[model samples]
Target: MESCLPILLHSLCFVSLVLQISYASDSISAGQNITDGQTIVSAGGNFQLGFFSPGNSKNRYVGIWYKISAGTVVWIANQENPLNDSSGVLKLTPQGVLTLLNHTDGIVWFSNVSRSTQNPLAQLLDSVNFVVREANDNDLDDAIWQSFDHPCNSLLAGMKFGIDRAKGLDRYLTSWKSVDDPSPGDFTYKLDSSGYPQLILRNGSVVQFRSGPWNGLRFSGFPQLKPNPVYSFGFVFNQNEIYYYFNILNSSVRQMLVLNDNGISQRLTWVDRTHDWRLYASGPTDECDTYALCGGNGNCNMASSPKCVCLTGFVPKYPSDWESMDWLNGCVRRMELNCQGGDKFLKFTNVKLPDTRLSWFNKSMNLQECKQTCLRNCSCTAYSNLDISGRGSGCLLWFGELMDIRQFDENGQDIYVRMAASEVGKILAFSRQSHSEDLELPLFDIITIVNATNNFSDNNKLGEGGFGAVYKGVLENGQEIAVKRLSENSRQGPVEFKNEVVYIAKLQHRNLVKILGCCIEQDEKMLIYEFLPNRSLDCLIFNQEEGVSLDWPKRFTIINGVASGLLYLHRDSRLRIIHRDLKAENILLDMEMNAKISDFGLARSFGGNESEGSTKRVVGTFGYMSPEYAINGLYSVKSDVFSFGVLVLEIVSGKRNRGFTHPDNRLSLLGHAWTLSRDQKFMELVDPSIASTLNPLEVLRSIHVALLCVQNDPHDRPEMLSVVMMLNGESTLPHPKQPGFFSEDSVSEASSSSGGKHQKIRPTR
Candidate 1:
């Protein structure tokens, strides 16, 4: 009986041990201790908390790391005080405090909570946050203390990298002293919340990089920080807190931002396929990323040689130094300011708003009030919107010389710089004289535009484009006009705005839209043009109900008018212009359905002897783009010819060139047209609405000309002059070859190799 009792006791003890192992939790209660070599894994098993030695160091430190990627430590508890031997013990006190104790019960590190609580517990969360709170509290916000509030060199997902205004707690990232050492290094990345909140990286007290102020979408300096499939990010600025955070969209994906010992901040993502961490992006990406690289009153453009240039209304302070590529002295104002009421502000677009370190801000001021406030202050050098969310609100004014300004290819903000009225007038006069061969364009005031368009009411909106929205406006004299208002979020800059004004204003033809004037006031940019009662060709041709109104005759007339406009632009206009973005949306129609070419923002003007030009940045619609231009960035008059060809086909078929598919095969509109023409089934290609009213000969002739224009080789396409003559039955049509971008496979391959879809490629216009 005694032997049987001993066996029964042993069995009960073994059962108790199994139950404890099965129910092991990632939490420690009061008076409990987790010694070295023991780990507490989160409930989801995503993170583990234990003592570890970083890199090659044998010294032990309490930390938390991803459970899957065992060696990747995210948070360190005893970073400054490393233990020589493996005698570390992590414990939770009865006062809701978490502390790390040494071998002799000596306190090595502890969490300083504002208040003590009963029934305390320490938990290692899946977010890699080590938290201490009341045992019954499940809410993370109710935690007494969290490791995320005191991050190490790595900023993990769900961590707030910002400031708590109410608590005066600033959470920032400091680099590690070395790969083997977790102590603070020389570089620190923090959010400067003084004027307009922006992220700045500093090496000690010296500024190394400035991540331009957060515009509605992202930091102006980080144009590449766009929405992606992997993660979502945003910035928050309010009375209580100001911070930036990012969260991964997919739970399987792991991403973190690490400020390396070398002072480079890198965004790295774990690549499962590669079995390693891949660099997603890095700060200080180029020479222009250097803080104040262009110095005061200077602009840096990475695409340009020497990278630095003086801002408009300013000249090199030291010409010799600037010429030698040593632009440390920057530039000085060309004309001294008199601080009179007659002073005007010159607006610079597509640029990183200058440093806000020495700036003032108002959160409730509109753009007009901001300009007025700046104009009233003699010391104000520049002014811009403090917050660009929604319709744009608030104001930021810079008093001293603007610094650290750089040019971005896209996604930039606008700044209004104070300039003498005389200087502004002189600059306008110089611009006018330079293009005096064309008609002089008038600049309208903001008030006039506002009253004309009823404050840009939604009901007055005509349409929207990649650049901005268009509104219907009427002058006091009863002159109806179409107002093209540039949106604050638009990537189009003053360069394209001025280009359209200069080119379209000078172009005179019954088939070309007339530009009446332009308006540049405060932060607004708009162009006024003669209103076409029938709207754009897309609103009609693409609509089944609208297409019924345009019979064969009207459609033929519309095609002929567009060809004439293109011919004039290619040869007859004062400037030999190439309408790179010729499309259905850019074609306006009058009351009589007469087509007029519009939106010349992407047009390029060539010298008399220059036949072609190449650009690193290709700009145009994908479906209308010429194969040579879209693939190699080589553009010429023939590029317009190809776009005209696509427009002609769309008008005939009532379908967009892009996204057009056939049941027979996966061919683009151009390819489908070519196949139909080759089979002599031209009548089948015409729109069903106009099928009954079709003039067979004219339809066949138009399709043939379009096919010739879309030929793979640019040399095979006819010039606009020849195209006009052919459409008028004045010239013989040649047999067309295979068209460019015809196969779906080729399109897919091109899109994949380019790292984006065809529709995602933005038109510079």
Candidate 2:
């Protein structure tokens, strides 16, 4: 018996060596097989394919789990029909089919196969996809079958969670029945293709939660998926497929989206420190995420005491139901559509667009065109930009009722909803009404402003302007504010004030000034803004001592910010707004010197193809005025372009365009710039204060762009969009023509006066 024991030990040692051989081989041929004690690891040894039992369960299943983190299963093969003993075998056939067998060698689970490969092999990729393909052809597209097409509870990096329309294959995530059971559970997270591709989570056939449609940047409702250091993600909608996928940006972090047994969808990342998984983020985080919680035409806000409220121009469909906390009926319009081309759209800012099941989209349409198209169709209930990316593009219009609308604190979207003319009138008349606090806009009272500003003390005063004096104020809650006191002498009446309010409130861009609320009481009207600590652009560029700090990069940033703001106004916004008062003082600067275009009292909105308007009363500053606008009373988007050119020149030279005088030449700033550009000495035009930090190429390009902008002919001037491209591009530019207001050494009052109902405003500090 002792002699036979040594022979038995040698046999057991040989068996253990055979099992260890399986761990290093990433791929296997048709003749190869893996038993319960053996396993196959990925090429990089990141993942392993083997047989395993789930938490406290005796039943075993063939699954894929992280090789680095033991017992953390990701994908399962025989989840529904598990083996009771350790007799499971996973093998590939000559037909390129992957099969799992029981002790009797009867196949319990098998992968789907379309066609047999010439050299059949089953390989586990580092991307976590188990594929059956030709050994000579490693291209993923040529694979006959892959485990990625059938994802289970865990969605690893590079996994597509969407559909392959032509092939009729839907790739999605299904929760496990329980921690101990690997069967498909009641919850599924998948893309719904009814209208747009929005992620929807369901408990059987009933929706449990929803991720709003993709808006170019991120999911409109999934703000949690923002710029992060760990991963980069995006949604793809092409002719062949539509899907959402994320890649681990940092290879050190192993992350996966898991739909747990509890029906909760969360992003999990493996933490090496704790040797366990940590929750990165979760969806349907609050009540507002519940699908259609407030039903159609209702806007949900978790910050509000009662989470749901009817949209403007709408009322609770059933008031009693709303009172009883049963708001499923949603809202109904107080006034029906006056569809004789009388219905108008009321813009709702900072909102999550409603369900899009009954919607149509145009990828090439502008916001103005979208508004007109919605008006043309009486059935259209609302419209918004489909792609809210750079400068914004595409349009999405919803028909019938808008459902599942919610409000976001930041990065929210703006949607235009159809409304009766009378309802629109009420909104226009809101400025004259008493103080009211609303979701879209808020109103501050006279007493609050007085208290905030310490009764208009000189110490709190920021600066005085044509509009009025600017005062720095701090609210009781420690929020700093900038209050613009509209002078009684200032020509901006309630109507103009209301227009400014409506425009600024609806406008949401990084380059535009953000208005908090307003004060309209005791015959006083004031515009409240988020205080900018760095004051105005004029302070930075025109002050000799302060101007030295602004290097070429900082100056270029200001130029780009202003250009982006003007571009948004002219082309991206719902209305084409002409910022008639574009001047140095009107440009506010944050602590980082980021420029924001403000003072919209003199701004005009042009609808449809109306590019220019002639006003008998000219407004805006003298030196910044364009030739056509200052002389012929013609103001367009080009006028703003001309002003931007003047601003760029001022920033470069550290001089004011209105009073600039060169030692060598008695030329105006425009004339001096033109002379420099023609002589190929544009770099000489840069500010002496920034001589040490100037980029000659950038300085030359800026001067050339300025010359292009201040051209005498409005026809010769490039549009703001083109100006942006020219500044940011290295393409050959067209030679600039003579400037309109750059005549000789002297300035003319008549030409300056020719540029308003009330002329020239000095913006507040």
Candidate 3:
């Protein structure tokens, strides 16, 4: 029995050895060497370490790649020292170092470890990190050396891309020379740890692109990089290190960010269905994304025809070059800033805060303090909030010219640029001007308005709103004007009145109501606008007797015109404005039945990438208000888009959204439109008066765009610019989720008010 037991134990031991050899590990102990073709895989089989060539190249190199993917190398051990033959050998030395050796027994490359140990091992981790550490040491921070410190072209999950302040070790991704070559390329993507931490891409030493500073959530310039199903990303800036990293939400979802050979940085993800990598996102997406594309003191807007334009209060240094579209020389101030008390800052909104290469910051300063600080500094050219989180804290002041400024339709930061007080005064005066060749606005006297309207007589009354009454007035020069007089008992105060004046005075578009001038005297606030004979849009669209006059063509024109006006306010205009009170009653019709957007009293201007805002005061018609704005007091350009969507449905059906009740379902107009559209019965939602004159395809498209605009999620709602494109059939529209406030009960509760007047509620802060 004892002899049989020895034989059995010997056989069992041999079998165990064979199994171990078959499923070989991804780790090597001290003094062990792995020759070419011998590979090591991670314990979890997520990553593999081996010697290989990169894309159609014969030169061999030691690298690590995903075990599930072929040739998708994430790290290269000896990228600069590539072997000409397949004689490369990776070895873990007894001194706790990893070295790449040639067939000639010469060291080709080696890991530089600060300390040495007798017991050493090299292991490939599931995080795709290759490290050489003491055999018993499991802590990463105590490792002798790691591949994460020397990345190639790719940034893998759990890898830090930034700087180790104490060690002065810069960890960054460098592009490959070419698809076939693994040598370092001209372009490098790294974190600029100076001032506020930001990502910067450089072609050699020249900056190519800069990801604006981290703003708690993301890099201000990269608003699209939000937390998603694929991964969770974050930035850490501290005394020890400053780095950006991402973690995969699901282990199965393999992802990587690679700075490609052509200098384009792309986030790619593996898709099992396609058996290929899908591009999740890419940057330097437009012409404006080019670093310093608009140069210093200039702003770049991709939506504009001329991509580059000088900043306000500045002019091209070389006018001829600017005219020829060469903005390399940037711009110079039109008027020199006199530092004393004569310099004022011009606030710019919805913009990518300027490059912070030469900047200063204070983590605890408020906006008011920031302004005072900038005012005190003679070299300060611009100032903004250092961190835009919560009520906004910290201060950032820029010296000299602001560079790499880009305008965004949404998600931006605000910057106040120092300007000559005279320039500031000129702008203020221009905003108040009644009529001048240099300005478009006109300032009218209260006496002139009183005389034009016959001293506020009822005969000249056009309509009454939440703000006040609109009166038809005839100027002494025989020009007809509509005067919007603020009621003493109205909820809208001087702030709203001045807000309207400031916004309407600067905006000029065919579809936007023209502001002739304004009158502010002895507690009387009046806005003078060009008179429209046809009155408001609701009078024509909601009244059954007058609705028939608006044929399909006229309604379509009105819709198109309103969209154009909205597009202007949201993108093309000098200032990004949100028409909070976008409704049928606020839309005025001209003599030719052209729709003109009026009443900017509830409007808000977004500055420096300011996409949305929250306020205690929610002002807008209930039926037209987006769910976010109505329920949460959160307003954005999308809020106006939602209102526009409701208006479109109302325009097409000739029904008042406020009192709308579906015949079969107890739904509001928006709910009814969404139901019909969802069921593919769009024609049923059309108004009987214009049904015969409607183009089926056009109406369907318009309905689709409207549905997109009224989507339950604000992000699901298309931007006004996108709305315009969809209306003109210039772009494809996505299927909408449920419409906001689609339920009958919710709609009823929201629209319980009388008179169809704009609702002004002050939410408890």
TM-score of each: 0.60, 0.60, 0.66
Q: Per-residue lDDT for 1-765 in model 1, tens only?
A: 000000001123322332344326888999998887777888888777777776667787887776656666677888899898978888888898888899898999999889998889888888888888888988988888888899877787798989987766889888777767777878888999877889888899999888888877888888788899998999888889999999999999988888877778778788889876777888778899888887899888764455787765677888888767888888888778888688777766567889887888888999889999999999999998877767688898999789999977445777888877644421132133245422224456687789989999998888775678889987643456788888887646677776787777556677888776677777888888877788888888999998899999999999999998888888876577887888887888877888888878777887658868887677667788888888778899998889889988998999988778776799988889999888988877789999889888888899999999989899989898889889878466788999987876666555554445434122211
Can you tell me which runs of candidate 3 are displaced by over 4 Å?
1-23, 425-496, 499-581, 584-599, 602-646, 650-765
Best by TM-score: 3
TM-score of 1: 0.60
Residue-level error in angstroms, candidate 1, position 231: 1.7
For all candidates, the clash counts are 0, 4, 15
What tens digits encode model 2's per-residue C-alpha lDDT throughout 653-694? 888887676667767888888887889888777888888887
Evaluated with lDDT, which candidate comes out highest? Answer: 2
Cand. 2 Cα-lDDT: 0.79
Per-residue error (Å), model 1, residue 269: 1.8
TM-score of 2: 0.60
Worst 10 residues of 3 by lDDT: 1-10
Better of 1 and 2 by lDDT: 2
